[model samples]
Target: MTPGARVAAAIEVLDDIEARRRPAADALKDWGLSHRFAGSKDRSAIGTLVFDALRRRASSAFIMGVETPRAIMLGAMRQVRGMSVDEIAALCTGQAHAPSTLTEAESERLASADLAGAPVHVAGDFPEWLEPSFIAVFGEAAVAEASALAARAPLDLRVNTLKGTRDKALASLAHLQPQPTPLSPLGLRLPLTSDGRGPALAAEPAYVKGLVEIQDEASQLAALLAAAKPGEQALDLCAGAGGKTLALAALMQNKGQIYATDSDGRRLMPIYARLERAGARNVQVRPQRRGGEGLSDLEGRCDLVLVDAPCTGTGAWRRNPDAKWRVRPGALDQRIADQDQALVEAARFVKPRGRILYVTCSVLREENEDRLAAFLAAHPEFKSLPARDMAEQAELPGLVAFASRFGEGLRLTPLTSETDGFFIAMLVRS
Candidate 1:
């Protein structure tokens, strides 16, 4: 396919994404089905354009002075994709299904486009109203932090210790030359560039045999914070698909009991099957009866309660570029409320002396440090744990030095770890 056809395909994908409120991956998949003629290279080029457009949507629109998909793609090609005016114009010639020819005005803007001022800041491609919250959390590093958010994230995978060690998994995936992630001992980092190939791990023997699971480094660290011990009672409250629960089981060496439950049984079902494949004998799936004792039976019995609460998911925007744009202001408000409620309810399951690990893939204060303050205030029995010290407790020699050199807690920006922007706070019941 010609460059023009790739641009045209990107425009179509973007339109479907914006109109149907679907994700870029889903839109691309739908487009691939409809246009079976598009080969691997064409799909790769088109996917790149769509992701680049989404990564800097606000700035692309501002630079082109047009909010339509075509204008955004054109501006992205110029400013982000680094396509020259002549190249873009030549590609957009009078070809079938090609992008419309650039007008003189569009050409001028393309030739001399400046995304300075607020647009540059907003170019993180997040909702406009979210700026203040991000500012509050990130402060002086907001723009750099936001810019990191706009960039592509690397592919990270956790070496499922249940099946194999990190070194063993790395050797098995020798062709990919996956490297040990700097932050988490259990994680491996792959290429950051898309390179037009689909997820490269699907065919690997380790991934197929459940020796490795795809998870971000920060998430691996957060799950490590739970510090599940053998013969202890652990509850993965809000265990959506049980990534952490699976991690915790490995920590416990499958000796302790993990009562994984969710308000919605549909999500927990997948975890049950995953636990089976993982050979996690200590895990028991308890489906709740529509808010009726979802965890009432385990009240005050858990040694570790992991509240992987839902939030705005601001930290993970780099991986899911479309999410940052699709999330509305009202949605954020609802998310915050949900986090508060989940914190209050999940806290009940913690044993008097046990700890609750509250985590969110968010860079917002209202969901992280602020929520901890509120929870501490409401429940005097619970006290905030020094997260920096806890992350240090992981005792992975490298992370200890990293935390010592850099102050910890509340927020982990993209710039800080090149991982997701995550916030984790721990609380212990008195």
Candidate 2:
């Protein structure tokens, strides 16, 4: 497909996403099925345009003074995709499958596309309601931080120490030239250019054998914050899909027991298989029928409790850029409520003097610092631990101030950590 056709396809997909109430990925899949004649390259080109537009949609629409799919696509081509009017015009020539020529209005808009940076309306790709929260959390660096969220993230893989060491796994994947992530010992940073294909690590023998798992370096760091040791009882209270649970199992060397439970049983099924593949024998999947009754025996019995609570997922926008467009301030508040419930419920299982790790894939204050403060207030017996001091205790290097806030939890942002945005707080039971 010609470049103009790709842009046209993206516009169509965006329109469906805006009106049909379908997800971006689903819309793209439907588009692909309907247009099977479009080759892989064409599909990829179209996908790139669609995602780029989604990443900067708010700003693109504001700059173009038009919210129609066509106007947004044209503005994105010039502002976000960095295309010139001439280049786009050539693609829209009278060729089969090519888009029609740019109208005079579009041409004029393209001519004035050179905004100094981002206009106030398009300052950040996030919703207008979140501008204050984002600015509060990120301060003067909010734009740069939000831009990082819009930027494409590298595929990160954590070598399962239970199956293989990072060095050995790195050696096996020499074809990819994966490099060590500065903070996490087991992490390998893959290239950022995705080639429109998902991360190829799944095809590697290491991945197939459960020697590696696709996890952000910051996530791995959050799991490490648990500091689970041999013969210790650890619990991943909100172990969705068991990514952190698996990491914890590897950290514990599959020893002792990890009571992996979530409010939803369906989310735990995949973890059972992954545990088997990783040869992890220590994870016990406990499906709770009710919110508070499940894991009654675990009350005050766990040495370490990890509440990997759900949140707005602001930190993960780099990977799922569409989330930035969908998330609103009210949604963020709902997430905070969810986190509070999950944290309160999970804290019940902490043994006397046991530690609980509260983690979120968000940089928002409510989800990070505010939650910790509320938890500490609710449970006066618990005290905050300095995240930097705790990280040092784990013998991890490459310390930064992002993780030094709140006197209890560590906050990891893309600007400082070069990884997904994550917040982790360790609380000890008095």
Top candidate, metric TM-score? 2
Candidate 1 clashing pairs, residues 3+ apart or interchain? none
Tell me the alpha-carbon RMSD of every candidate.
2.6, 2.1
Query: Global lDDT of each model?
Result: 0.80, 0.81
| Candidate No. with top lDDT | 2
Candidate 1's C-alpha runs over 4 A off are 39-45, 119-121, 192-198, 396-408
What lDDT tens digits, residue by residue, belong to model 2 across residues 1-430? Answer: 7666777788889999889766689999999999999998898778888888887787777767788887777777776657888987887765766677888877877877554576433666777777777878777888888877776678888999998898899988878878998889999987746433445566789888998888999999988878889899998888879999999999999889999888878888889788888888999988888645768998989999999888899899877877777776688778888988987887788888899888889888878889888878888988887766677767774454556444457778888778899888888888
Q: Can you write out model 1's per-residue Cα lDDT over 230-287, one digit (the tens) per residue?
A: 8999988888898888889888888979988887778877786677767778898887
Pairs that collide, model 2: none
Candidate no. 1 TM-score: 0.92
Model 2 ranges with Cα > 4 A deviation: 39-41, 116-121, 194-198, 404-407
lDDT of model 2 at residue 330? 80
